[model samples]
Target chain A: MITLKDVNKNYSSEVSIGPVDLEIPRGGITALVGPNGAGKSTLLTMMGRLLGIDQGAIEIAGMDITTTKSKDLAKIVSILKQENHFMTKLTVRQLVGFGRFPHSKGRLTAEDEEIISRYIDFLHLAELESRYLDELSGGQRQRAYVAMVLAQETEYVLLDEPLNNLDISHSVHMMQHLKDAAEQFNRTIIVVLHDINYAARYARYMCAMKNGKVIHMGRTEELMNNQILTDIFETPIEVISTPQGLLACYH
Target chain B: MNSTVALTPKPRTSRAPLYTAKLGLGCLLVLILLALSLLTGAFDIFSGEEGREMFAISRVPRTIALVLAGAAMSMSGLVMQLITQNRFVEPSTTGTTEWAGLGLLTVLFFYPSASILFKMSAAVAFAFIGAMIFFLFLRRISLKSSLIVPIVGIMLGAVVSSVSTFFALQTDMLQSLSVWFAGSFTSIYQGQYEILWIVLGVVIAVFILADRLTLAGLGEEFSTNVGVNYRRMVLIATALIAIATGVVTVVVGSLPFLGLIVPNIVSMFRGDDLRSNLPWVCLGGIAVVTLCDILARIIIAPFEMPVSVILGVLGATVFVGLVVKGGANAR
Candidate 1:
């Protein structure tokens, strides 16, 4: 379980996020969905302990993020941000090996290698494991990075915009993979998604935010109504029931 | 879907033999250069007692200084590039060497009789502070092109060097300052050159922290998320760079592009996994510097030219090539 209580971050005189109080339960997919500049990434990063909280507390499985040693926190939670750049040349397999750093500290054991291979296979990146990251396409690279985060084997996986550069089929594939990981591994996954339809399709829970505040938090079905999403996005959003599922169309 | 299919898992093959081969070749090259450097000086080692004394007191120490300073500076350059996430950044380019110079000048002005240890510590402190300032500036200004980083660093170095020049002129130490700035191993001896051994310790520490440094190069958020203390790693990298630069600057003066060019050249061949790339970087550094030192000795026989002059010509050419390559990549 992840908890944020009255958490705040002040960027400048005119920009600040939170006084947010929220709890994300353990297990399944919880999607944070909102428009741009809605502090989705900021909140996710703060929970990941990539960014420090100015006020209040965030706890991952009852361990206070602010007080917990980073090495300890790393075992319980892992985060993948949107933009990742590397100065060194690293193969996909080597990059995934870094996910075991908290445990192995660069000396990967046979067990660690087995786990790495499993995650690579899970992400369907076994063919590309020997390929350098710079040689891969954007979607392939994104999958490699996701594989790295999964190889961390953390209970709480927080991903900020995992679908940023992916195509339609890849996006769906990624969501399905995340869903399977969440269920099979019994891990809690919090993902910040841009496509409301994707969120509606795969997420078990939804947290809608606007102007740095969580305006709506409930079951995915409850948060799928037209009025709620329209208010949260400040746009005319129409929710129509299709044979596939509930889909929200803004255009 | 076919593309995503798993291949048969390849057996893990030990790279120890390949690494050993590379190490063997590198050591052979450095050893050859070391032999040439030891033999090329004014006194003949194949002769009598005076020649043996000269070999012991002068040539051997100078050769050792060449190896130590070379390896240390190049590793320093590699560390700086990793920390800054820029390819062109090095101790000289990033104002670190200039800051060390300023520290040396200040010490010379205030206490003319200061020990080498005091001078080196002062320089290290200033270099660390200077590198910290550069990082702070980097955080504030979001640069689009990687080329701008080194340009800004060079300008920052110019600013610091100007300050040193100003103080040197006022204190009437301009001539002495210029001589010190032109790096050479001519003055190195057993007594005066022992301080450079600190670089070996720094190199060992860097080897231990190699993996962390590579992770830190991935960016702050990713590094911290992976449980590497990003700030602590940066601080450690900064200290290593400062000590390497400070000790080298004090012992042999500033080797302008030795740091910049050596690492770039090594990475072009070995890639940038810090752990694997480290030994190659050190060996390449030692080889390049020793070769340059040999040239410096023979270029003006019986009278030596400063090693920095040769390095400057070679470094500037390679630096320009890198900028062009980087610009082409940006496009």
Candidate 2:
């Protein structure tokens, strides 16, 4: 379980986000959904220990994230941010191999290599494994990054905007892979997403934010109503039942 | 569906053939450069008895000095680039070189006959302080704009340089100051090169903290999230860089672009994995410096042009090549 208590983040004099208090239970997909500037990404990053909380503490899997040593914490949680721009020319396999750095310190054991291969296969990145990261298309690169986080083999995974720049087919594929990872590997996955329908479909639990605070939090089914959707987004949203599940239409 | 079906498990990268071959090639290049540097001088050192004495006193010390300066400056550059996450940064860019030159000028002006040891000590102190200031400036700015970092650093260096030049002119020491700031390996004797040991110590520190530097490059939040002490690591890296830059400047009088050229070339050949790239960068630095030193000796024949001039030309040429190649690669 991940817990945050009264977390406040002040970027500067004018912009501030949250004294937010929230709990994310273990063993499911929890999607953080909100419009731009809603602080959903900020809250997720803070929980992942990627960002510091000015006035609060975060605990991941009962370990205090603020005080835990970096190598020790790396074993428990892994996070992927929105951007992964590197000046290095790295093959996909070489890049994913870095995921084992905390464990092997760049010396990959056969077992480490095996785990890397498995995650690569899981993300359908096997064929492009030897290609350089800069050589791949946007969606392929996104999948490679996700694969790397999974290769980290941490109990909890945090991803900010995992679907950014991906096409619809790739988006669906990526979400399905995340769902599979959650169910099969029993890892707690917290993802910040812009697509509300994707959140409704794959997420077991959902947290909706407006400004900086969590405006609504509940099971996915409970949060998938037209009234809550419209209020959360501040736009006219209609929910229609589909064969797959409930889909929210704003346009 | 077709793409998913086409997926195949990736083969593991071995440390034997592929890695070892690259390592061997790097070592070979270094060894060849060392021989070339030892042989290429004014007195035909490879041919006769005068060769051995000249080899021991002049050629040997010169070669060792080049290797040490190259490795130290390149590693310093690599660390700067990593910490700042900007490609254009070097020991010179971060104001360490300028500060060291300033320190030297101040010592010369204040105590005209100060011992070399005292001068070097002052240079190290001033350079370290200047590096700290650079770090503080970086800390104050958001890491979101790393592109602005090199610009800020260059402007800071320019300010320090102008101040030093102003002081030099007032004291009529401008020529002496210009010679030291211009960067030449011509005056590096055995006693003079002793300060470079401090730079070697810094190289060891870089290796020890290599992991932290790599993590830090991922950004402060990510590094902190993974449990690194970001502020402490940055401070340590900055101090080491200052020492490296200061000692190199005091010994060789500053070698323009050795740091910038070596690391970028190494990164182009090898990936940016610092652990692997470091040794390669060190070797690459040694090669560039020794080769440039040789050219400086031979290019002007008996007159001997400064090594800094060679480095300036070489660095500028390589810088242009990298920009053009990077653009072409992007296309």
Candidate 3:
């Protein structure tokens, strides 16, 4: 379980994010969906302990993020941010191998190597495993990063826009993989998403944010309403039940 | 589709055979350079009885100095590059050498009778402070342009350098300062040259800490997420780099482009895994410095020029090449 108590972040005098209090239960896919500039990434970053909270504390599985040693907290939770750029030119396998640092501490045991390869194959990245990250396309690169976080093998995984440069098919594949990861590993996955329909499809719980605050939070079925969708997005969204499932259609 | 992969997994990527061959070639080249350094001095060791003494006193020490200082400075560049997260950053570019020079000058000014070890310490301590300042600047600025990082460092170095120049001019030590600071191995005899061995500890420490350093290289958030303390790693790296730079500056003055080019060249060929890149960077450093030092000795025949002159010219060409055509292998 992840809990945030009176969380606040002041970007400036003109902009600030919550005084937000939220309790995210363990073991399912929870999608943080919001319009642009909704502070969704900010909130996720705070929960991941990437960004410090101004006036609140975040606890992951009873371990206080501020006080718990980073090395200890890493085994319990992992985070993947939106933009990750570094000067090191690494292969796909090498990058994924880094995900096991919390467990292996840079010395990869045989088990660590197996886990790394498992995540690689899980993301359908087996073919590109030996390739350098710069050699892959954006969609392929995105999958590799997702593979890295999954390889971390933490109970709680936080991702900010895992589907950013992905095409429609790749996006579908990614969401399916995340859902599979959650169910199989019994992991708690929190993702910040821009696409509402993707959230509608795979999100077990929907946490909708608007203007720097979480406006609605409930089960996926309960939040899948036309009025609620339209209000949160400030667009004319109609929830249509196709054979595919519920989709929020704005266009 | 669940396929059973091997537990050990094959060696990463296409590195196994090619990496060994490359390191083997680098080792062979280092050996040849070492022989050349041993043979190409003013007195030929094979010719006379005093020649063996000259070789022992001067030639052998010069070669050791070249290898140690070479490996140390180049590795220092690697560490700086990793810490700053920019390929262009190194002791010379980041003004670390300049800061060390300032430290050297400040010591000489105050305690004109200071020992050589004292001088090295002051320079190293200043180098550490300078690197931390550069680190702080990087932390404060967003770095929209990658080029701006080196520019900020160069500008900061210029400020420190001018202060050194002012002090040098006032004390009438400017001429002596430039002479002592030139990247030359001319005065490296047995007694005074053993101080270069201190950096061997730094080189070994980098090897032991290679994995943690590489993790730390991926930036703060990534490392922190993986449970490594990013700030502490940077501090450790800076200290190592400062010691290398300070000691080298005190002993050999400054090798302007040794740090930047060696690591960039290695990464260009071998990719950027520092643990793997370590041996190559060290070998490349040894080869480049030995080759340049030989060239420095031979360029003027009976008279010798500073190695920094040759390094400056050659290093500038490669540095510019790195900048203009940088997008090739560099990401």
Candidate 4:
């Protein structure tokens, strides 16, 4: 389990997120959904220890994030942010190999290479493995980065806005891939998703945030209602049940 | 698996043999130039005992200094570029060499008879501080483009150089300062050039940390997420750059653009994996400097020109080409 108690971040006098107390249970996908400036990414980054918390503590799998050595923590949690820009040119395979750095320290053994290739193949990037990252299309590059993070072999994977710039089909494919990884690998995946429909369809649990606070957290069904999402997003959101599933439409 | 034909199979298929051939050719060129540099000086190596004495005292020391300074400066530029995530930056552009000059000038002003060790230490200290200041300044502003970094660095360097020039004029050591800043291997000797050995040690350290440094170049969040201690790596890189710049500045004066151009050229051909690219960068550095030093010797015969002038013209031309290509790509 990953636990956050009184977690707060004061970016400035005007913007702050905090006093959040929550527990994200292990296994299954938890989608953090809300409007812009809702602090979903902030909370995810804090859990990943990419951002510091001012007031309280975060514990991932019973180890405090702030106290744990970064090298050790890396073996437990892996995070992929929205934007990853590299000044150096790197191939898809080489970028995935860096995911093994925490374990092998840049000297990848046979086992590490096998694992890297497995993630590459799993992500359907075998064709692009030798291609440079800059040469890949947006969707392909996003999958490549996700492959890299998954190659870390960490129990907890946090991705912030992994679907940005992806077309609808690619987004659905990526969500399916992530859902399968969560189930097959027995990993807890927390993803910040902008599309509430994807979260409703794929996520087992949902955490809604607004003004830097968790407004609601429960099973996907419980948070799928019109009242809660409307209150959380501060917009008129209508929930309609279709043949497929419950969908939230704010249009 | 689905059949997805490789779009660029030829580049991959031809890379290994091409890399080997390039390495072989570079080594051959360096050897030829080293021979030319050693044999073509004012004193003929074909002569008897007097020639042997001259070779040992002047030619050998000069050659060693060129190799050490060249390789170290180029590697230092690569390290700076990685740490700063900017391709245009080098020790000269970053005010590091100018700070060393200022430090040397301060030593000359206060302690006219100061030992070389004292001068070197002072220069290293100043260079370290100057690099730290540049890093801190970079942290404060969000850069619009990579070109802005070197532009800012050049401005910083100009500011520091003016301060050194001001002090030189006041102390009436303007001629001495100009000679120190001109960067020539003409005065290098066995005893005077031994300080560059410290740079050799620094370069070795850089090699050991090459992978980590490359990771650090990927930005702080990514590097830290991958378990690298980003701040510590930055500190280590800063120290390496300062030491390399300081030693070269004190020993052979400032070889502007030698650092900037060699690594840029190397990365243009061999990608940016530091461990693999480092040797080529060093070899390129040594080869370029050896060629420039030879040109400096032969272009005016025994009169000789400073190697910095040749490097500056070459570096500027290449830098402009890179900038133009980069701008076109961005557009």
Top model number, lDDT: 1
Task: Give each prediction's DockQ, rounded to 2 decimals.
Answer: 0.57, 0.42, 0.49, 0.48
lDDT at residue B104 of model 2 (Cα atoms): 88
Top candidate (DockQ)? 1
Candidate 2 DockQ vs. native: 0.42
Q: Which is the winner by TM-score between candidate 1 and candidate 3?
A: 1
lDDT of each: 0.89, 0.82, 0.88, 0.88
lDDT string, candidate 4, B94-163, tens digits: 8999999999999999999999999999999999999998999899878778888888888999999999
| Cα lDDT of model 2 by residue, B1-331, tens digit | 5545453353466221335777788889888988887778778776688777777877778888888888899999999888877777787766779998999889999998998888888888888888888878987987564446767887998999999999999999999998887777777766667667777898888887876787677567656645566788888887888888888887788777777888887777666767767778888888888888888888888768888888888787976676566557553
Candidates 2 and 4, the one with greater DockQ: 4
- Superposed model 2: Cα runs more than 4 Å off: A9-19, B1-11, B14-19, B44-52, B112-115, B135-152, B325-331
Q: What's the true lDDT of residue B135 in model 3?
A: 88
Clashes of each: 0, 2, 0, 0
Report model 4's chain A TM-score: 0.98
Q: Model 4 segments beyond 4 Å from truth? A: B1-22
Candidate 4 lDDT by residue in tens digits, A1-251 = 99999999998997899889999999999999998998999999999998889989999999999999999999999999998887787778878888988998977777888888778878888778877888899999999999989999999999999999999999999999999999988889999999999999999999999899998889999999999998888899999999999999999
- Candidate 1, B164-259: lDDT as tens digits: 999899889999899889999989987999999999999999989988998998888878878999989999999999999998999999998888
Local error of candidate 1 at A63, Å? 0.6
The lDDT, on a scale of 0 to 1, for candidate 1 is 0.89
Recovered native contacts in candidate 3, as a fraction? 0.58
TM-scores for all candidates? 0.96, 0.90, 0.94, 0.96
Task: Fill in the DockQ of model 4.
Answer: 0.48
**What lDDT tens digits, residue by residue, belong to model 3 across residues A47-163?**
888888899889999999999989998999999997988878888888898898899877778788878878888887887887788889988888888888888899999999999
